[model samples]
Target: MAGGGRGGTGWSSLPADLLLAIFALLSSDADRVRFRAVCAAWATAAAAWCPRPWLVGSRTDRSGRGGGTVSSFWLFRPAGAGAALLRPFAATVPEGLDYLSSSRGYLALADPSVSPKAVVLVNPVTGRRVRLPPIGFFKRWLDVTTVVLSADPGGAAEWAAVAVGFPTTSLAYYSSAAGAWARLDFAAPGYAGVEHYSGRFYVAFGSRICALEADGDAPAVIPLERVDDDGADGSDDEPKLPGGSGRRVVETHLVECDGQLLLVSVHDDVVYSSDDDMGGLAVDEGGSKGGGDARAVEVHRVEWLWDGLVRLVRETDLGRNALFLGRNRAFALSAAEFPACRVNCVYLVDRQGHPDGVVRVLDLENPWACREETICPDDATGGSASSAGWARRGWFFPNY
Candidate 1:
């Protein structure tokens, strides 16, 4: 909010109450985060607001991981209305660690050299970090898909973290009270993604929804008789996913929105199978097949149908809410509340976990129809990557 008072400089330094009032009017998370970045006074004032976390995308310049390999990560707002009104959150990250997904405001980083997998949760905002116990002698080939937290480590001493990915039979979790990473092996078919909601972690598998209840070893898929438009519980009326141009379902995420549960499924023609598989990323030097890295995103509202039964109804209008969906703990933000986000849309981190991949925001048209929104960073042109290292990691909600 620039204004020409006192030689065009007073607007940046508004009183706390006035800034809080202005913060209330923003509908995008990015704008609110930028609001705090205005100056020292604003950041202090924002502690009173504790605004929602804005979406952050990273560009890891995978073109060459040559020498000393220190990567800098910048967390900015994810809004379709793309003028960075504030300073983006930035940090000079240490070398040898790759960014996994983010939770609360901490970046879940993986140290590959460690036997098995050890994730270090670092909050770039306050520089507070929690080193998770490395579980199992798991190899790097068995990649961990996404991670979610029950509470922020800075805000609470006890936190629970859940991660799911490759090999398909196991998920990893951390209980700060237990003080170690433990694996919860399961017998379910390929789990797509998991979301921590209502004190229970919900896991989505093939055509099924399951919830992890209270330190349980694994989640059991909830059987359901689909609820159709007629309000009848029947599987016959389950809506077809919004089909795209030969796009395949690469990732599925469960998130909480508008006080309800939402299932977000991402489809793409070009999937990044190997981030370490950088050789293939080079093949598509044409830039995500002319910026078509992610082709379609399908969102469904979860309808709990009493007694272990659930229905997934397709949601067409998200109203003021926009969602960030990927391997990370899925989350939704309101444009009416934050103003920096696009209303009724899905923000996608690149599939195949490419730090330097593309970020696509798909506008929700209807259950059966959706077109991509132009989601480019502020420094880029036409919502497309201007150069290399433009891949988006995921969304991180910042409190500090």
Candidate 2:
């Protein structure tokens, strides 16, 4: 008969390796840290497994300071024991322009006051920033700047940063490769959304949606007809209207989902896909022979892409009004509402609920509780009658 060690209740005699393995399964980083000090052997294992640095989610509202020049701001994250305040260290920034775009860990700054205004690229986390050469749009009918971060897998090892400006008269693009800004001699109506998708950059201003190829060169705008095709084929295609004519068109918004670029256009009640191709537009044999009109464009009639995004939306307990979209699985906050939690930095949870998904709030700090008015400026608060802003502004239940 083998002799067992003391505390035979089963924990004392367990090998250090076995004990460490059991502790490794714990998800809480705080819990993991405490377990390490239980023993020297345990500490060694804990250090290796707990190497992920905790990135604080605290962000300032660039639009909320000084006056109404900037609007209300909200900061949010997943709910859990880790839900703590996210504070920022002081930093310097240029005057006038707002921070319009962020990607590849950098923020795009545009100065609206200056003629041919200067657009500066900044990385707040690393404290590194750069100002690009000016664009000649001072006297023009308002030029808007948008920036996106992209990685060209088929080309450069480093990520590519693109800045696009649309003036009433023309359009232009800037790239880190040129190390300078240049003009794009084209016309677009007006873009409602711009973002980076799947290692490639995307733009949705006006009626047309465009993408840059992963090869890292100047990307061509996709004509309305071919907007659905993948970008793998290389053809020198110029943008054109539905009748292959030069008429301007535009969309209200665009979003990236499951590797595909989706656009919701204002012209027609349709939702078109770029098939995740860095390509511009696509067409079918039977439709869009005109090239610009959404000839057979896949349609989803919701005005906002978020409305048709059924996957992220879910029903909650509060008369099915509360809903939450989790990073892993969806959950509900109240009714058609999802409460923010403190698990990680997850502010952009759609109405969809998920396991890891959480809604983060800036002022209402606890991730494990709720307040009478979960939403700011809500109908309950004498603001707009619509509660949409309440959800969009990032409020959630405290899961921790």
Candidate 3:
């Protein structure tokens, strides 16, 4: 037997369930992979630990594990649950390649090492990987607006779906099971961004919010206007916004908060944008019919409260500013407004006062903080914020 090896008692000696329980407690993806390498028994333990897509009522806890992990994960440890980046699995991709987007626990990476224009989809937790289909001609031209990983709303196992938006106003999808890429049936190549939440996936383009219905053969596309019709499309020649003023030109971001789809944008300090047009406005002649990117869009004044609980606790005109939400509320911060020409502190405006109490201010400057707001922009525009409860441990892995 090898020195220091447990010759007498192997991993099999452990009660199968007990081994599973222990593995479940170690949330770090790197740790999980390391445990598998110890011996065949450990590997078996990991294989037997296939997680069901949904763990009902099982909250994501991420409090301990010291600083961070090698990759990012929404994981649970005995201490707590939160989002963190686990160490990257040993894989080949070029260096300086950064993470682009993530959804359904999968990430899209842009590494210059492999191909100059390709994005790699990988599950940091299991080190499962899939190379995105070649963007072909589009790769040679338009910049990729967004590349997000999502699960089929219909409940497919171990199969992740990829949604990519192009500046050419096109949207493409790639599925793990299909092993191929195809364009979504929707028209208006103006598709800009995507997000997944509450058993559904959403894409925001021009002024439309479309939902993905994976329950059928092919994912069904439903316009979100049925629920909330008031969305802004910036392509209109003479855009109309609330308050009789022209709509503030700004970008949109999608976030899953408290089981509801949330829209956030930063237009101006203290005066985030708001969409009072309950009727749901539309851009007139914005489509190709319009000469320019005439997409007529509405902006909403947003005040992020605590987590996803509160909406519009404050108000402002949103435009080039960056917005972020946590728990029930949201915050709007703009680099252009700050004298330092950068965000230094991101104060959480709870009902009573700032969560940090003004003394030990939340360091918005922390790379982690910036990423909190920026990495997963509701619109995938890229910015940063503080580490959420679940994002602490895996902060080491860059989520882009």
Candidate 4:
């Protein structure tokens, strides 16, 4: 009735509060951007509300291989099947860039075509990019296992970026305030994973958890104590490393949920074959071709004890949050926020060389009830059941 006078009511006639509420329900960043473009009032309201996160997918070639010229990307709504292909800013993201990791809406990319590989951070939403020193700066390390950011580069005045490699003997970190990459002196030969939480960097080396400051000072190492070990039950069938080897190959992940740090341990078994290339060696105990298929995953909540030591508090169940762990980045989403997502579950992309690009959902409460779904369907990625498709893929979170 407010704008009922001549040519019916228009979107601009809507009240500011009502427009803010309606825009808040929009889960897509593109939709929110269009909403703000409607009029001046709508734009003002939309600028105040925080938008929900979106799951982004990189466009692969028809063959589903990892690195090629990527002209466009895809966005998937967390709550529904709505997806859209988006073109990134030209200067920010160049052609033939391979995505490695994502944090706070920024992507860490590598250009394989260049000598000594070029690494840069890209924010697609803001069209901002910052190129770091070449990968060779990190002591000529060919591959970086994980990269994490201390703050969003788009909004923060100062930020820190950490790049770690497998069999890590030291860490290479970049601080915006210093405008240079500095090496953190530490020896972690069996480094499993690294994560940034609570203004500190945490690393998992073998079975030990160590904490370091963002600038790489004040180190504290903690050993994890398992409460439910089979040895404690006096069982002779205690689990041991594969092939009766005393040393075990484990995959570790550090995640932050509800303002708490969580350590996830995934047991892996390494298999050696004379005919196979060392680059394609399998890391999982399941004898799979890749390390993507984890045999067992255990989650533990980190607790700071009174004796100035850190201990792991095992969590039997996750209440409403579901975790998604990829090759480098990890995400925690609550079912209450997105009803379509399952609670107490872990979702991961197919690592077993499956052509279908299947995503596996593991239910922590009922481990035997695991399920698999195809994300890059045949029609989406242009891959058949037999073709080796989309070798390199990752999850992206867009914040605008």
Candidate topping lDDT = 1
Off by over 4 Å in 2: 1-74, 77-97, 111-115, 137-145, 151-159, 165-169, 205-207, 213-219, 224-251, 264-400
What residue runs in model 1 are displaced by over 4 Å at the alpha carbon?
1-15, 18-45, 48-89, 187-191, 216-248, 269-289, 351-356, 366-371, 376-392
Candidate 3 lDDT by residue in tens digits, 1-400 = 1243366765456766787788878755577777777767667776766441101000111332211112222212223433211112232222354444444444455543345466666665555666766655355322354555555222466454545543434455666666655556555543244666555566654344566666544666665432222443233322234555544434444554333454533211112145353222223221121122222323332233343222221122233332332211122334453221123332211111111111011232232222221112111112311222221111112111
lDDT of 3 at 386: 29
lDDT values of the candidates? 0.59, 0.35, 0.38, 0.58
Instruction: Count backbone overlaps in model 4.
Output: 3
Return the candidate ranking by TM-score, descending: 4, 1, 3, 2
> Residues 143-223, candidate 4, lDDT per residue (tens digit)?
465678889877788888777765676777777887666666556555456778878777765446666555344323333
Name the TM-score of candidate 1: 0.69
Specify the poorest-scoring 10-residue window by lDDT in model 2: 308-317
TM-score of 2: 0.41
Candidate with more favorable, higher lDDT: 1 or 3: 1
Q: Sort the candidates on lDDT, descending order.
A: 1, 4, 3, 2
Best by TM-score: 4
